[model samples]
Target chain A: MNPLSVVVRTICDIFTWFIGIFGIYIIIHGHMTPGGGFQGGAVVATMMAFLLVSHGGKKTLSFAKPGLYTAMETIGLLVFIGAGLFGITTTFFFNFLAGQGGVFGATVPIGPNSGVLNSAGTISIMNMAVGLEVIGGLSLIILYMFKGIRLFDNAAESGETGHDR
Target chain B: MKKRVLFMIAILVVAGTFWGALDNIHPFGDVPVAPMDDYYIENAQQERSVNNVVTAVVFDYRGFDTLGEAAVLFTAVCSVLALFRKGREGQ
Candidate 1:
């Protein structure tokens, strides 16, 4: 696939990093604010789509390996599940780390106030985990679709049926 | 002519049902009773120490649901990857 004109590429290059940063901010601030992992991850994945569309498949593929995405997703799932299992001695998905005065273990005041960053223990960790998984999964979907379309183009050019033999 | 009449009837039926359902729905933001909401609002800060009640509900009170959502997304990715496997292997 041919990439878009230089103007679009320039815009994408300049703005994609900002989008990624905003998405990370949203994921991290999930327990304190509204947006969470899924929404933030979708935002980041939108940046990936912008890159893919402007740069074309070959350039995008050169930077983004599907294997790496798979690894990220796997790691995210493992971490999320591991975090959940940590509290199994009490109960499944117990909030053991809350109010413990450790990292991510500060007791929130019982009324409305400006929330602390390091307050919600396991919830914050899960947010990051889900964020990673969503970023990897969404990017992989778009990448796979683009690659599949290109494969059809290649088969057609080489005078072979794109369908299975 | 027959098809047009049938289509009109179908549209009317769908619109009427939607209107009826909308009429029955609680007015705007006014709920009759929200015991669960009150409970979560009162307890979430102490139980989870999170300012965002929605996040507390999602990641703590209803964590298994989030896990299921993650599984669904994983399954979708796996399906898409499987469909495109031939393309990768042929290269």
Candidate 2:
């Protein structure tokens, strides 16, 4: 029974890692391709849920930090919204600001039709915001779920068995 | 047992085939199917201030979706609260 459980858990881990990678791939290539922030974020969140279920509570969620996740989500959204307001002069949501151009760790040509994946403008910044918000928010949700389940189970065992804390 | 597995596989195959067919059709392509044109990008650009059109669509344009997502978080919190609340009541 133990061995079978281990095998099932291993398979689940592999599937979850695949989900995480696919989610990230969609987010990063959001500019050139279609997949962007919200879709990729949900994917990552589901992957986190998978991880929490496969691994024990301590291993998967002991590090659950609500404050940090909240901060990241708030900051990421602020940045995303700020980008839009800063571009208020030209267009309502023109993303063609400093964040709009750069190559792999290098700046883009600082002109029109610069490099494809350069960190210019609205797309990259927004994707980043989505990434941060989704990863933190989703993980927190799943971690809290596990915490609730564990608490309920423990309480039930204690109450039913007439045990003292 | 074998019949059950085969039946499940048959259903999966039909579903997968339907998905592949839709993939060819490309339902989300830039066009109107029934009444409204593919207002996805237009709608997105109109609402949000974000540069990435998609982000605007999710965060600003469709603020309700974000709210619903927040509700999901709240639901999870409520579940956790239930466990603790019940225990405290007993004690």
Candidate 3:
């Protein structure tokens, strides 16, 4: 695929990081805000799509390692499941850390008030985990779909010669 | 002509079902009484220490569902990777 015009590439360079920041914000603030892991991760994955659109397949594919995304997806899933398994003694997916006065364990006053970041315990952890998984998963899907297109083109070319034989 | 009549009957049946269902549906924004919803709203913050009741429900009260959703996404990615792995060796 051909790269877009220089202006689009330049704009992509400037705005990609901003898109990343916004996605991270939404993921982290899942407990206090409207957006959550999946929503935020989809937003972050848009950054990869944006990059692909501006930079074209060859440059973007070379830059992004499949191994890294696989690792991220695996790690995210493991951590999410680990968080759930850790509370098995109490109950599956128990809020054992809530009000425990540790990381993500601070208790908030009941009723309306300002939101607390260092609260919501495993919920926050799960949010981040799911966010990571989604980022990896969606980006991988986009990358592979692009690669598939090229693969189809190559296969078609080969199949034509084979048919002639 | 018979086929067209059958199609019309099918369409009318579907539309009538939808119309009957709409009559039974609760008005928008006026939620029906649900004890579980009430419990979550009244006690989610106190019980889970999360200001967002929806988050509490998703990640705490009904976390198993979220786990299943995550698993579904993982399987999708895996399938995509597997499908595209054939041409990867030469690249």
TM-score of chain A of each: 0.90, 0.71, 0.90
Each candidate's interface RMSD (Å, one decimal) is 0.8, 6.8, 0.7
Q: Could you tell me which 10 consecutive residues in candidate 2 chain B have the lowest summed lDDT?
A: B42-51
RMSD of each: 4.9, 10.8, 4.9
Give me the displacement of residue B80 in model 1, in angstroms: 0.4
Candidate of highest lDDT: 3
For model 2, name the residue pairs that clash.
A95-A121, A95-A122, A99-A120, A99-A121, A100-A120, A100-A121, A101-A120, A102-A108, A102-A118
lDDT of candidate 1 over A54-116, digit per residue (tens): 877668878988888899888888888888889999888888899898889999888989999
Interface C-alpha RMSD, model 3:
0.7
* Maximum-TM-score candidate: 3
What candidate 1 gets wrong by more than 4 Å, as runs, is: A150-152, A155-165, B1-29, B87-91
Query: Per-residue lDDT tens digits of candidate 2, residues A3-72?
Result: 1257667898679878988998877866545677667777887876666555554556556576787676
Query: Which segments of candidate 2 are over 4 A away from where they belong?
Result: A1-4, A98-115, A150-165, B1-91
Residue B46 displacement (Å), model 2: 18
Q: Candidate 2: lDDT of A97?
A: 49
- Candidate 1's iRMSD: 0.8
Instruction: Give candidate 3 misplaced runs (Cα > 4 Å).
Output: A151-165, B1-19, B27-29, B88-91
In the range B60-82, model 1's lDDT, one tens digit per residue, is 98998998998898999999999
- TM-score of each model, in listed order: 0.85, 0.56, 0.88
